[model samples]
Every structure is written in C-alpha cells, then in structure tokens.
Target: MFHHILVPTDGSPLSGMAIEKSVALAKSLGARITFLTAVEPFHIWTDNANQLAYTREEYERISKESAGGYLDSAVAAAEAAGVAVGRVQVETDEPYRAIIDAAVERGCDLVAMASHGRRGVAALVIGSETQKVLTHSAIPVLVYR
Candidate 1:
C-alpha cells in the first residue's frame, strides 16, 4: 500500500532495472514516483593547494548537471509507463545520506533501489550504500538486485 515511491538511480544497469521495477510497482499500486540522483562533490586536496582554489559554485553547478542527466532518464521511463513522477537532483558526497534525505523530504512511503551486490572483501572495502540506507533510513526499503 505505497502512496509514494522513491527510486534512486546512478545511470548504472542495475539502477536502470531498479527504476523499471519501481515504475511497475507504482503503476500496479496507483502510486506516484520520485526519481533521485546524487552527484558527488568535488574533492579538495590540501596537499595540492592550487587545486583548493576551485570555486565551490563551479563544483555545485557540475554536480547538479551530472545528477540531472541521470534523473532525466528515470523520469522518461516513468513517463513512458504513464506513471506520475517527480525528479530530485542532490549534490552530496554521501549518496546514501542524500537518498534517505530526499525520501524523507519528499514524504515517500517506500524506497526502491538496486543493490550493487558486493560480497565479502569487496563489500568491506567499499561499503554498500544500499546497506547503509537500509540500516539508517526510517522509511521502508525494497532492494532490487
């Protein structure tokens, strides 16, 4: 019984599949969808002081563009399925945090995302964002692999 569904996409094949799944689920339940993409902020290296001179405004602009492109695809898919949808592009270094924040801000009833499905050493080395969201989010999460 989901009224609003939040789907995060990173332009990956897995994320594409997740978007499709989310759209289908929303259509079946007569729910609206929110497609979100988080762009990573530019990293500043103190060792290379010259690089630190980069403007934060420039970084924010680039991040917004990047996230917008990814979210556009998800929006297109939802539109094709005749599902009502909204898009959100957030600039954040922490993708999981951004995703959860968007969901809460949008008042989404559920979050449907794709898992990278990392395992063992890889999982430990590059912690799963999906896992982190599952652990920390107050809203319900449905992961698609």
Candidate 2:
C-alpha cells in the first residue's frame, strides 16, 4: 500500500490524464499525493518558442507561473478526490532527475506518471523523461498511458 505518491506533470493532455488517474489511485489507497512539475531553465540557443521569445529573467518567471498552474490543477484534482496533496516545482535542465530527486526528498513511495509512448528514432532523438525516470529511479513507478 502506498502511503505517499508522487505525480509528475508537464501540463500536457497526456500528463493531465496521469494526474486524474493518480488522484483516483491515491484516493483508493488512502494515500497522500505530491504533484511535481520540473521547469527547464532558459537557454541562450533553443528551438522552444517560449525560450526564444524572452530574456532569461522573463523566461524563468513565465516558466514558474506555468509550472504553478499545472501543479495547481493537479492539487485541485486530488483535493476533489479527497486525497491529501502537496506540490513541488523545480528548475532543472534534466527533468527526469528533478522528478526522481523530488520523490526521494519528499519521501514518496510511488511515482506515477504519463508516457508519450514514443518509439525508435522519435524517442531516441527527443528523449523521454518518463523513460529516464523508469530507468534511474529506485522507487516504484506506475505509468498511465
């Protein structure tokens, strides 16, 4: 039985589904949840429109706001489900490491997340934080497709 679960989201529809499912699972298990969103720091050269549009300070500010919105949504879901919840937002280039570190620091027993289900070249090129978490984490992971 999981006493505490960590749910990671990136504000995508896929992650939203994972948040809903994780809240339901936490409710069923009488467990508390920690919602986490890892925000990547702004880089000088990048393809991301948001990063390209703003200065470092502006990008950081915008990223934090976005992450807060995502975490708030998850918290609301868990609250509605009667599942106790907390949230964490971290700034990191490596979101997978941030997710794992947050789970361990927060004492979460399970890490529940969504998978984009990429394969072959797409996965290899874009890389998968979910895949990295699955590979690196010592704790249990429950993936929602």
Candidate 3:
C-alpha cells in the first residue's frame, strides 16, 4: 500500500541488497521508489586553527556527482525490475537527519534500508545509522539485513 518508497543507500554491498529488495517490493506493490544518498560535508582544517566550511560549492558539486552515480545504479536496477523510480541527494554533516528530511520532503511513506548487521565491538564502535533513522523517523522503516 506504499505510494512513495524511500530507499537510502551508502553504495555498500549491504545497501545494494536493500535496494534490490526495495525495487522488488515496489514493483509488486505498484509504488514509486525514491533512491536517496546523503553525502557528509567535507571538513577542512589546519594544524593550529580549526574552522568548519559548510558552504563549499565545489564540495557540494563533488558530493552531488558521487551521489548521482550511486543513484544511477539504483535507478537502473529498479528499471530493470520494471519499477518506477526517482532520486534525490543532499549534503549534510548529519547523514541521518539528511535522510529523514529528504524522505519527508519527498513525501515518502516508507523507508527501506539495510542493516550493516554490525554487532559486538564493531557495532559499538560504529553506531548503526539505520537505528538512528528508526529512532528519529516518524514514517515506517523496513530494514533488510
């Protein structure tokens, strides 16, 4: 019953699998899929001084290009599966916030993503972005491991 589906990817193998799943599900349900990627802002600093630059146009351009490649792959996969798809990318320091915002802004009803399946020390070391999205998103999230 999903009209708009948001599929967030990091270009990882696990995220690729999630994209496949999302595409298949969308095809079955006759839903439109939105493939999204969040590029973290580039940080530039010196040894003595620290400064944050969020308005680097070149950085944003590169990020958009990188995200476009990933989104292109997702679109191809969905098209091959006979599913309608679109894409969106945003540059932000907070990836989770960017993803959730994009989903809401695009009017997506569901978010389908992959769990890296990190556990134990690894999980602790690198916290789960999927978990953060689940915690913060008001929309439904379906995680594929």
Candidate 4:
C-alpha cells in the first residue's frame, strides 16, 4: 500500500488523468498525495531574437503562475476525495529528475504519472519522462496512459 503518492504533472490532459487515478488509488489506500510540478526556465538564446521574449524574472513569474494553475486542480480533486494533499514546485529543465528527487525528498513510496504511450520512432523522437523515471528511479512508478 502506498502511504504517500507523488504525482508529477505538466497540466496536460494526460497529466490530469494521472491525477485522478492517483486520487482514487490514494483514497483506496488512505494515503496522502503530494503534487510536484517542474517548470522549465526561459530558454537561453544566442541571437538577438531573445530580446522579444520575457526576461528571466518575467519568465519565472509567469511559469510559477501557470504551474500553480495546474496544481490547483489537483488540490481541489484531492480535497473532494477527502485526501490530504501537498504541493511542490521546482524550476528545472529536467522534469524527470525533479520528479524522482521530489519523491525521495518527500518520502513518497510511489510515483503515479501519465504516459503518452508513444511507439517506436515517435517515442524515440519525443522522449518519455515516464520511461526515464522507470529507468532511473529506485521508487516504484505507476504509469497511467
């Protein structure tokens, strides 16, 4: 049984599904849920085109806001399910690492995440974070596609 579940999301529809599935699993096991969001920093550009985009500070502000927006829904869902929930946001380009680190830091026993279920060439082209987590993480990962 999972006592603490770590749910990593990016606000995608698939991520939303993972959140719901995690909630149901948590509810069944009477486990608390911790939601972690990894937001990438504004990209560094070598050309003058970078001037058109927001500054680093601006980017962080907007990113945090958007990440919060994503986390809020999960919080609401957990509350509706009558489960205790916690939220964590980390700014990192590598979300897969962030997810694993959060699990260790939060003492979460399981990571429930959504998989796009990409196949072969497409899967290689668009790398799978879920696959990376499964490959690199010592903790258990339950992927809901």
* Model 1 Cα lDDT, one tens digit per residue, 73-123: 889989999999999876665778988898999899999998862221101
Ranked candidates, highest TM-score first: 2, 4, 1, 3
Residue 99 in model 2: shift from native, Å? 0.9
> How many clashes would you count in candidate 1?
0
After superposition, candidate 3 runs with Cα above 4 Å error: 45-63, 117-127
Q: Which ten residues in a row have the lowest lDDT in candidate 1?
A: 117-126
Which parts of model 2 are misplaced by more than 4 Å?
117-127
TM-score of each: 0.80, 0.89, 0.79, 0.85
lDDT of 2 by residue, 85-117 (tens): 999887777778988998999999999988853
What's the distance in Å from true for residue 70, model 4? 0.6
* Candidate 4, position 97, lDDT: 90
lDDT of 4 by residue, 1-145 (tens): 7899999877777778889999999999999999988776565662323223567677567667878887899999999999999999887657789889999999999999888422211111013777898899999999887
Q: Write the per-residue lDDT of candidate 3 for residues 1-145, one digit (tens) a residue.
A: 7989999877777788989889989999999999887766555652211123234565556556766787899999999988888988776656667778988998999989887522211111013678898999999999887
Full ranking by lDDT:
2, 4, 1, 3
Q: Cα lDDT of model 4 overall?
A: 0.78
Kindly report which residue pairs in candidate 3 clash with one another: none
Candidate 1 — which pairs collide? none
Worst 10 residues of 3 by lDDT: 117-126
Answer with 3 or 4, whichever has the higher TM-score.
4
